[model samples]
Target: MTTEPFLAPVTTPAERREWILRLLTGTQRVDRIRRLRESIILSLLFLSALISVATTIGIIYTLSIETFHFFQRVSLIDFLTDTQWTPLFTEKHFGIWPLLTATLLVSAIAMLVALPLGLLAAIGLSEYASPRLASIVKPILEILAGVPTVVYGYFALLFVTPLLKRFIPQLEVFNALSAGLVMGIMILPLVASLSEDAMRAVPQSLREGAYALGATKLEVVWRVVVPSSLSGIVAASILAISRAIGETMIVAIAMGQVPRLTLNPLVAMETMTAYIVQVSLGDTPHGSLEYQTIFAVGTALFLITMVLNLLSYRFLQRFREVYE
Candidate 1:
């Protein structure tokens, strides 16, 4: 290729100055085009975001306003303080505790089962498993996620409940424990997959250096991999918790429509989603406060899940440290 400068033919000082000015102007024009494109793209994204936020806030606002009207008729103090939650009766008691307790109990059981098992699986996949083992096992783990939740609900109701009854006679046929345990299994892929990604991203040189210093595989994993991936592990746990909280069909079918204010997982309980399903399945009157109750429960559930996500993000920010 010819190596002569493009400006070589412009030998005169005047020509050089003109050429330089032309190049500078051309560069400025290109910069302007790039800036305009960036601004347009970003503005479109920002506009989309504003619409999303407005829609979300509008729903919350509409629900809150209607809920306030409901409270005026139903009494906020009683709703907050009372234990019973029968909203469709002549007596019309509407406490938030039963729903809250049910959601809490199911989520707690799910977390109890999912956390340790998923984390261990992630550890094995990232730290100990051979390539052949991973190739065989990863798909197997993911299969759990692919199973339809309705099918799990069916199994929980027919198979699991009966099986549990054989061992524990007092266990309810439809209980929080069965629902939570199944929900945990359902969300296992979320925790294991994300945590494995995080662990794999840890610097290989860190492991190599540890091994060079006479560290065993266990020591390297415990000290380096787990610590480095702590933020991601925590985030996975939080996400698993979120999934457990939001699961619908499994809890709806397996967990009975009994919104008890008890912590005992052996007893039947109804989650927020389950109660919503129960209420809607009955085809309750559209304009009734009972119909609007789902939206209120939904708003509360939304806030709780959002808080958990925010907390997870904060943990991610604090623990992530990458070095050159």
Candidate 2:
């Protein structure tokens, strides 16, 4: 083997320190740029979220101002206690209960149809249906939601009411039962889709554990899945109620313009939304009592919807399950 000469490495401490300082400076600059970018993105997201809050605030303020004007011309006592709602008549009555009672009746009828069918559909889709079947069926169910409310209104008026009249001869041409039934069908997808999603989110491990305990598939679904997903299921139901309450066209066309205090579902009845549509369709000039009534009714509608959502939130908080 031939011997080779060794070369000594040379580097100044000053150069070494300078290179290290440059590297640290670059890293600090990069970190600062990254932080700035992150801050900008966060700021944009916060503003985007605030937009909805601001819109809601604006609506509440507008309604409050107009409602104050309405209460000036109309007494709160009369509005609450009067049995009639002939606001446009020469002998005007503003008893809100008639409209309120009708609204509740329609909503109750709708829930009766929606809850069982929706819950069952959700359970079947989440537990029983094969993946391919669910994929096909879920979309078809949701397609009902995509249909225009106007179309549903027409169907209720032209088809459903006539069909019901055959069974119950007392049913009117325009009645709450038909509107409510179609409205329930319209809201069915909301309950089913949301509840099914909630049930599906339940861990497979829970089902496995139930099976290990010698439980049947139905038992696992009912005991393990349904109980755990109860919060979401309740939320879905509440959301459907809110939709039913807000729906205008179906009730307007099928339930008629008459506001009656009676509990019977076969008679023509008007909801708050129907009243609003009636006023909007009329030639009621701006700043008139007729115009102000819409805002007042809208305020009430807003309050009712808000209460329902709050109830949903409360129930969700109370029943929500924590899973590892």
Candidate 3:
């Protein structure tokens, strides 16, 4: 066998330290890094902040410009006062009410479906379930939230509508009921997760105190835990309401494109976002007043959602307690 070249033995700690120092002092890489001595950390943070600020400014500026154009053609009164909507036709009428009605109708339906189911789920997760069971179920419930809205829309349009047509034949292909119901399912995880957290935050001492006073489990939960967590529940509900209002894709697909003043759930109706989508998807000229209508509708939606979210945040802040 051929012998390899003999290497020198390792040095003592002090000798090794000296060697490392000499090497590092002469290193070109370190010298280069030292040369560009500007605060790279600060530059990165400032750049990130600049991007965020720029994005906000761009959105606001674009929306404001188009909304101004739209308002010049359609008066504020015409936009707000008129109840009838015929945007795409020869008889062009601008009305906020029909869109508002469609949005509210779907939102009301979503709330109705989400509230009770979410509350029950929250109660189960926080109060009734074992730790092992909760671990299994919570992630499963979250999967429902993870499903894409467009998929939910398809399920609503294809499955739910056909099923409903079996009983209520008058139920239109793209009615508010299917859209609202699917929206509720889409929003279920939001309500359930938040409400569960709020319910879980209630102290065990409160439940024990109620039980010590000869209260049943049902009574303890209803009187003590639920009441103490009332603010949180309300906050969660408001948050869910905010989501219901802003939901776009599901509404656009499952709800019809028709902009109608009718209150009937069976009739086809268009939401504000849906109206924007309908207009933008059409072949209207880019600079025309008609194209600008999208931004005006968007501004209206933004105002509504912003108000709702602000209210929710206020509720959460006011109602939150120091559990300690």
Candidate 4:
């Protein structure tokens, strides 16, 4: 049986013209309503995108204004050159390098631990594990992402430092090594999740082609899948490093407040974020140089993270694979 039309063809010419006119009018009304809805949705999305850009501009302005004030009182030369960072002390050394060094040291340690483990985990989950196994393990591993940074700090100071002390007797109670190692663990989930998504996005045909050429699973993954996904992997690594650099509580609690220009991970050190937290916690008078110190450190932190993001975007563009 065939479905009947809502309106049968009219026998009269005048009736047919009337029916055609009504249909066209109804269609036009529907098209107008659809266009109006699309315009509203598009405008809302454009406004939403502007919010982030506006927020970033506001942050840059705030940091720049305060940092300018800080540099007026404290010489830029001293801030860059001096060995010690004793801004709150009676002697008042304004060297920024010590805190920067500590920040880099911790970030370096975190990457060292996170990159290899996270990449390997991503590879295993994407290439080797069964779908069911990958589904179970990925979520379990990502549970680390939800764990609070404060908890990680407590764990570092209470558990990790002591654990390291057993093997390295010289480890300080509040040290960079424990803090960095814990930060690495905190970053692992982010790296692994992003990387696994990237690798999984690769076309299955590429893998099949490799197999037809007698390439083993390992060879296909390393040579084809990994190279195709290199952009995403690098992006994930950059994001993880930026997260490590901006982390405050974990480094503050575990890495101590001493601003020493030393590379020794076994000793106590201070990061830019840790120093900012310390100043914020204290009752430093508003408009004073000590108070302004937070803004200056924040400026530096913002610039570093921004550079990393830019670099990530550059890498993504450079190695992006356009699969047909």
Candidate 5:
């Protein structure tokens, strides 16, 4: 004879109902726990976004308040039309043109140098270079970006200026040319990396189609790849320009603090960033007009950067090519 195990069956309706409720409760509990975790993750992401927004708002507010005070003391017409920028001097003339022109000139030179070289590098990396070569070269190229601006500043002052002086005897020791050239070198990696990524994002099918039409490698790259990636390239250039515009240390060290409204790159000049740095060195007393000038300059810089970003966004939206 074998021993049999007894099992309890839910014979009563109440017992069956109780069993069903227990199973439902377990599933509901699991669902509730999942929802809670999801809510926590969502909250964290929202907080991160909020923090960024808050920081931007805070900066804008600070700039705005101080800028308002500055404008109250100095008329807008004088600020815009005045050729001299001698805020720190006893004979104060509050024209922003000198700083503005110097900023533009340096940025223009940087763009001239960086754009062509970077575009060429990007093209070579994306269309011509082997994967092994690209992998090795790209990292080495990006290493330039990691080098400090202060180091670049000293290099421009100590090395590049002296070297250029040999070729061009007219070049000033502390001039816009050396600073601009070094600044361009500093920003080249940004353009190359970004433009290469954009070029690489272009669909391979487009290149194949161009090749099928008996196009050469150069033709395919210039016509198919470059056109498709134009938005990204332009965006990268704009970003690099903004970087050059806002550059402080390199320009400050290499380009002398003489605020002059001249297009001559061989002459020493002061940029808006350089001006801000000059003021921020703690020599200017707090609550003074000299101190307030930094805020006004900052507001202008903020506006310029914001405009560039907006233009980049608009261009990307208008010209971005979508691939299936």
Candidate 6:
């Protein structure tokens, strides 16, 4: 009977070393490819971040240069203290107070309408509504945010203003009240969605603990969930306020372009964004004082938003609750 011969294994140290070297070479190739891929991904991420930083720096530089030119032509004291803001008229007055007061007035009214309603909606969604109901309602509510600002502006001008005029005969055709109310509705989703997300992020263990202490659902939500999520709530409110401040189309179309330094919500007034819109309508000369006014106003709006963001960051840092 013929038997097949068995192949011998590598017995020498040199043969074993060669096999190990081959294995290591393959592993090294795989590792090099993986590292190359990772490096490409990291570089893309860095480039994206660099683009955002560059865009912000460019905007700041442009605004600073134009604002400097503006200050050279106009006095800083008059810009801050002057109550009139007619740069278009033959008698140009550049007092920024009128626009500033109107912007604040409209934004305040918007917050008055939005804050309580948004908070209540968030509470209802997070604590009361079933998951099915929340899923259905949230998308529908966010639809309002998806609606174009120009459409909201027209809705305010055509529908809301007419309705309000019937109830309040003293209301102007173009008034801050309608504009502010519409702006509030426009930003409501931002507040509600953000606040609900924060509330939902509260740990279930915390809720169970509260329940173990015989606390009701309402009690647990208010006493535990809300305090835990206070930073997010404040952040949402500040973001909504910033949105209202920067709103251009709604204030331009419905709030009127009249820069009046009055707190009365029933009267026509102009916000900073609306004034910028009015100036940008191609009627003003490119290098004129009227042209430079938009940049100056934009600088002020940017500063205000930046300050609000800084305040929000500080508030979040101070009150943020971390959970394992």
List candidate 1 segments past 4 Å from native.
1-51, 318-324
| lDDT tens digits, residue span 134-233, model 2 | 9999999999999999999999999998898889998999899999999999999999998998888888999999999999988998899999898889
Q: Pick the candidate with the highest TM-score.
A: 5
lDDT against the true structure, each candidate: 0.85, 0.91, 0.86, 0.92, 0.91, 0.90
lDDT of candidate 4 over 23-57, digit per residue (tens): 99999999999999999999999999999999999
Better of 2 and 6 by lDDT: 2
What is the Cα root-mean-square deviation between model 1 and the actual structure? 4.9
Of 4 and 6, which scores higher on TM-score? Answer: 6
lDDT of 3 by residue, 77-173 (tens): 9899998777677888888889999999999999999998998888888888997898899999999989988898899999999999999999999
State how far residue 133 of model 2 sits from its true place (Å).
1.2
Q: Which stretches of candidate 2 lie over 4 Å from their true place?
A: 1-45, 317-321
C-alpha displacement of 59 in model 3, angstroms? 2.7
Residue 249 lDDT, candidate 4, scale 0-100: 93
Error of 6 at 97 (Å): 0.9
lDDT of 1 by residue, 1-324 (tens): 876887579999999999899999999999999999999999999999899889988978987876666766777677778898887678877888998889988888888888888999999998899978987898899999999999999988888888888988999888987888888888888889888878887889999999999999999999988988888899889978878888899999999988779999898888888988998889778768887788777777888888888888887665565522
Instruction: Give the range where candidate 3 is weakest over 10 consecutive residues by summed lDDT.
Output: 2-11
Q: Roughly what TM-score does model 1 have, to 2 decimal places?
A: 0.81
Which stretches in model 5 have alpha-carbon errors above 4 Å? 1-13, 26-41, 318-321
1 against 5, candidate with superior lDDT: 5
lDDT for position 156 in model 4: 99
Using TM-score as the measure, what is the rank order of every candidate, best first?
5, 6, 4, 2, 3, 1
Total residue pair clashes for candidate 3: 0
- For candidate 5, the 10 contiguous residues with the lowest summed lDDT are 1-10
